[model samples]
Target: MIKRITDSSAASPGALCRLLWESMLELLYPSNIYCICCDNLIDDSRPYSLCDDCLTNLHWANERTCRCCGKILKEGYRWDICTDCSSASHSFEKGFACTEYGGAEKNMLLRFKFKEKAYYGEKLAEIMFDRIQPEELDVDLILPVPMHKRKEKRRGYNQAAILAYHLSRYMKIPFRKNILLRSRETMPMKGLGAVERRANIENAFTVSRGWDTIIKNKKILLVDDIYTTGSTADACADVLLAAGALRVYVLVFAAGANRTV
Candidate 1:
């Protein structure tokens, strides 16, 4: 009898080729060996694959932040909440972020979201995880601000989901992607005023069937790539609260500049 290689026992030609290609790529161009922001060489010990300079230059949101929205407030600004938060009531209980949305942070996040650099999600999530206080981890579950099916399909992946997935791993919280969904397509939020952005995202999200029971009385942690105007986050929080979630707190990678009047 002759022994034959089964599909399970033998490497397929395509798999072998891919393995070789990946091996070659790793040998020639290693991953995480360079800073994600400036492409400077970084060591394994560097947190978030960022160099010392990039890390120092990054706009961390650890300074005075808006009490309601978590965006960094300018110095000498006496308001607890940002101008945007003061003008409108957000559905979320509160929010926190890892960095301010500007300069290097903005450029990096834009590349992460629109340029298909999904690996950035991991480092961003790690930073966001560091932003969460011990008491904030009391949430019962974690969820991403969902993207519409069409948009997600077109974009290849939902950035928020990617961030939330990594964040769940870091925080050891249960993460659900499909429980909260974007049920409607909306226009681009860019260039939209606060009211316009709110209206654009209104009713855009809904809880899936059978999730209401699980959501009921649960303290939820909502994750997103960025928080601007609180429109999308508020919309998602509204639906989650309506589905019986006791509380929805937001964790975003970046918070837009405080629109102080």
Candidate 2:
């Protein structure tokens, strides 16, 4: 098991040396160090698990995006509000994504979620943090989009909670994991149209009883791995607002280009 390192029990020189040696050995072994993006062998000094070539191709969301939803748009647009935001009424005030959901980002999210690669959560959270302004996004509480009980039991971890923990630490905000509860497991939103996705997730989430005492009137930032149709976030935001939250905002690692509202 990986023990949390406390100040009193710092890593010893021998342990550090052993870790470095193991990392070097893994790099030397031809089959061990596979790229997180393309499953290709990566060189020893690469910062991320992705190979340099894949890193070059990685698409970061650097364009001027929607002020409300952060969807990248074509040039000559006014304030980057996409058609979806222009037409739809979303519950959350605004949201931002760090990257587009494709290529390197898709691979990373899959590994993090399905392969139980927990370390990727930290890297992903860091990337998400880098894209937002802490002061401007001053939130009273940080909440991870909750996983259903059965799903959490099966996976043994909630990726969104893990990401929220790191983000709370980095931003000096209080991370409240229990405020929002997934009341039911909805069908997967993949391949579903926006309206269908919304209906699927609608009423699937609820604020935990008594959580109102902790979250009432608080400005909350909801953290999640991906933003697709905005259904899940919208549902959660609706519940949170109904439960007396002053405002809600979402932070997601990636946004799908094909999805809107």
**Which of the numbered candidates is closest to the native, going by highest lDDT?**
1
TM-score against truth, every candidate:
0.88, 0.81
Per residue, candidate 2 scores C-alpha lDDT tens digits across 1-261 of 111221111122333443354345445543226666677876656655567877777677787777777766545665457777777878999988877787778777888788645545655676777877643786999999998878776665678987888788778898877789999988888888889998899889999998897888999999999887688999999999999999999999888773342
- Pull out the clashing pairs in model 1: none
How much lDDT does each candidate structure score? 0.80, 0.75
Judge candidate 2 against the unseen true structure and give its global Cα lDDT, from 0 to 1: 0.75
The Cα RMSD in angstroms, rounded to one decimal, for candidate 1 relative to the true structure is 7.2
C-alpha lDDT of residue 242 in model 1? 91
Model 1 alpha-carbon miss at residue 111, Å: 1.7
The deviation in Å at residue 151 for candidate 2 is: 0.9
